[model samples]
Target: MDNTLSRREFLRRAGMLAASGAAAPMAFNLSLMSEAAAATAPSDYKALVCVFFSGGNDHQNTMVPYDLKNYQAYATIRQSIATPRDKLLPLPGLLADGRQMALAPQLAGLASLFGQGRLAVVANMGPLVQPTTKAQYLSRSVALPPKLFSHNDQQSFWMSSMAEGASSGWGGRIGDLFLAGNSNAALSCISVGGIGLYLSGKQASSFTVGVTGNPQLLWGSTNLFSPSYINELKVLMSTNKTNYLENEYVKVTQRGLNTSVQLDAALKAAPALSTSFPAGNSLADSLKMVAKLISTRAQLGNNRQVFMVQLGGFDMHDSLLAKHPPQLKMVNDALMAFDSAMIELGLQDQVTTFTGSEFGRTLSSNGDGSDHGWGSHHFVMGGAVAGGKIYGRVPEPIIGGADDVGQGRYIPDLSVEQLAWPLAKWFGVPDSDRYLVLPTLARFDADALQIMR
Candidate 1:
């Protein structure tokens, strides 16, 4: 084999390196300038947290019906996975059509947050290319999202407005717009959930942190092996190269080292939070680290920030009744702890946390479990949220119902563009400039989705 590499081979190797280094807190890209127009920082600071549930969650079981009629309908359809009527914690008030909603017993903490006006449920939200209904969906007249019900594509579509393999996402695009506003632009977008497209922007790239604290490794904190041996390794990483692929690697490694040191020092000096996160819970672990990072916002000079945290194992195609409840408990407990941490920091009003899944699972059970679905219920929590209310219309829980495309998979009443509008507005994006961050914003009137205060 020849020693020299071809251009395509080099690019493929570079991609492989990126995949392996996703968890590192590094500046991965160096392209100067971007399409996200710079804007002045808002007087007050704000942050957005996206908690992605890796596999599609079973939302039908997550938010159950409370009314006698609807509960019977849900219980009958859900069969094995149905949350008991008496065991459900009812959310106050009813949907637009007088249908009442309740939470799974494991989600009582979130329900309490809802009662305190710090949380609101966004019902039946999913990716849509346009404002589509059952008629348009059935008639196949509207442009629909490509690769529907696909885990990977929907995850990408949920983060980025486009389908899988899109270069940028709304969060990263939002990060792009405010790069100049932050005292240290590199710290604007953080990810505790490793590398993801959600944090990749036109010019801005994310600085990934860990679920514990800033990572301290031999390369990051100490000289490896012999002094000269580690010194040579550092030299190799720091040296600039003529090839684009080689040069990008040099930049990513060097930036990772530099940022790690800075972040570690800042976190060490930051005060500890009084709130206690549940032990051994992965979601709580991630959110606890997010809280710690937020505690250093003033010192890091991060005025506008977006974070991505994630948990896996929600696919639930089998053993759903047994496996799902524990995960839901984790979600409820972690969020409760995070809310407390924010309150302790007096940043609850400033930070907004939301949950996301690739998609929802079907209402019709496949013997012991549910299948993949389209529309799902999600939670948004913060002091600014219009809590104690359900934002979108919760579809009835009947198989072959009006909203169902098939197998009790209801068509979403609101598009993801409509959902993200209020969040972008609350985070300081100008109304006229939203099209840059959200491509399909023009198709929907986001005015009605007043999710924030």
Candidate 2:
């Protein structure tokens, strides 16, 4: 008469249901799938690459205010980690309020991109439901994103406009809008960074691949298994059982097998890239895989795609000066190589890469390093970008300026919706469908940023 199930029993049943594909539809919205299936293919190819900087990045150090007046304020506040003035890579003619900004010496590759007009800096961006000022933030006048300084929550907020437990990401929603445009909807949103919330949609989810351009095969499903075992597994996957759970598992397994074959063939057919990514850089490895995937777009029958890659270790609560340079250099080198690879592939203008972080570190150092704060600067680069300029208002590098909330954490002048909307518009999402991708976008300005050509 006891109905209670043991933990192992519950998990076993859940796994069986998942394998049967009974849980797949529950993971996504069926109505959204129908809508996406009805949409037509895009006329031309375009892709968005999101390079997520896990852990908060220190924007003050990344994008330095090099002009004498501002530099003094920055150095005074960040005494231990300040880059020397003369050593800074000067960004000639890219000035904000008559004060020139420069990249740290470590970011020489990005500096070159800036000089070549292939990159633009987006200043002081963070998640906001609406336009908010320091006064509003202080007075609790506007609804703010939950858990402002927490890494996981802020990362989710930036990607999905909600804290943790958000069902869909803006990128995934974008993928949902264009899933039908691709021959294989499963591959429309690819992630080299593993399964990220940023690429989880109601109707579409990311197809994760390794840095080596291989699809993630299910356990015991590869050539290492015995022929008889593989055959039995295939038979089980192909069986059309009447039980709902078993049927779902078969469907999901079949889909995975098909996707693996397709991806492997496409990757094999892709031309080798000549661009040299830095040796031993994990970020570079991820970007290299993304480049290979992009090269296989035609073979995969994709006109629109979204890709995500990540690099961690930015949460430098200590050793900021000792550690930040090499990390930044790795990012710089990988991005520059990726840009070159795009050019070599003759798809420079068709691809756009941008940076996102959970939040920015405090402008004021906590002796050895900085703590989590808000309003970080980021970069957007591609042949189509209207580059060599700063897009948003640059906050004065003062500890207690009008923009600063506290400890030089400037309240963001631009929202994540503002940053994402332009990219979505450029990717061919119609204005009517923009709300589906960015739920908070309607509250902010409808006009897309002029950063794109």
Candidate 1 lDDT, 254-289, residue by residue in tens: 555555656777888988888999998999999998
Error of 1 at 137 (Å): 2.0
What would the per-residue lDDT of candidate 2 be over residues 1-453, giving only the tens digit for each residue? 221233234346546333523222222212223326434678799999999999989888899988888899889889988889988988878454698899999889889888889899999998777888888999999998898889888999999998898878999889888888888777888888643689878778767777875423245554312334435666767868886655654565556545655777788888889999888999999999999999988888899999999999999999998889888999999998999999999999999999999999899989999999999999999998989888888888887789999998988889999989999989988888888888878788767478888
* TM-score, per-candidate, Cα-based: 0.91, 0.90
Model 2: which ten-residue window has the lowest total lDDT? 22-31
- Residue-level lDDT for 343 in candidate 2: 96
CA lDDT of each prediction against the hidden true structure:
0.82, 0.81
lDDT of 2: 0.81
Report the C-alpha displacement of residue 190, candidate 2, in angstroms.
Answer: 0.4
